[model samples]
Target: MKRILFTSTLAAALAAALFMTAHTVTAAPEGAPAPYRHVVLFKFKADAPKEKVAEVVKAFAGLKEKLPAVLSFEHGLNVSPEGINDGFTHVFTATFKDKASLENHYLKEPAHEEFVKLIKPVIEKVLVVDYVANFVDHGAH
Candidate 1:
């Protein structure tokens, strides 16, 4: 019957549309999600004084104001908070919409560069982990 054929065709079309949408949503931008992770860890040099570390922390916190891509910034001097143990001097997490935004934060933002320059000498090592947002809860933000 013509009705049966039309119904089948419609079902096929709907399936195709759904597949396309799912594919598009899953296909994140380049470097959006790395296989490993996106964890930026910074270790300051031993020569850095306590006051200098505090100053650098303030400067790093100010990055959010200078860059729109950086939606939120969570930073603090690494300390064993009660029972939790974090073995590091400092830690800051920067979240962006995509990898491009993160790259722009480094390239386009002048203040970011200044912050880098200010802490370059005292910085021991920096670790960066880039990854995609597999499952994000919008309500949490």
Candidate 2:
């Protein structure tokens, strides 16, 4: 009977530890800074030239090197078969070190300003979303 009781207690302790570990792994760190993501979606004017659009995308991607705040940059053309993009054809993502870097450095950087000027004429509509990137562990799901 004592052996059975000991085994049950051990099992309960092990289960509690596993539960704590899972929660710890899944929880976001308290007060830790995460990278900021700047997402831009562009819908070009119907008459916008293809070359100009290409140039704009190229210029935006180059901001990663031109701006000290940009940690990474990438862009992609919309290819969703769902046809629910609302006419947004291009998507660009720029990762910054933090919100401060994006708000202070990248926004005021001349290179970014130039890119905005270069793209403005051809761009019909633009949507930008900025957020602190709190990544969830995919495996945890």
Q: Each prediction's TM-score against the native? A: 0.59, 0.76
Model 2 scores worst on lDDT over the 10 consecutive residues at: 20-29
Best by TM-score: 2
Q: Which ten contiguous residues of candidate 1 have the minimum total lDDT?
A: 132-141
Model 1 Cα lDDT, one tens digit per residue, 47-84:
88889888888888888787777777887666665744
What's the lDDT of the predicted structure labeled candidate 2? 0.86
Local distance difference test scores for all models: 0.70, 0.86
What's the TM for model 1? 0.59
Q: Per-residue error at 101 for model 1, in Å?
A: 1.1
Total clashes in model 2, counting residue pairs 3 or more apart in sequence or in different chains: 0
Top candidate on lDDT is 2
Candidate 1: C-alpha lDDT: 0.70
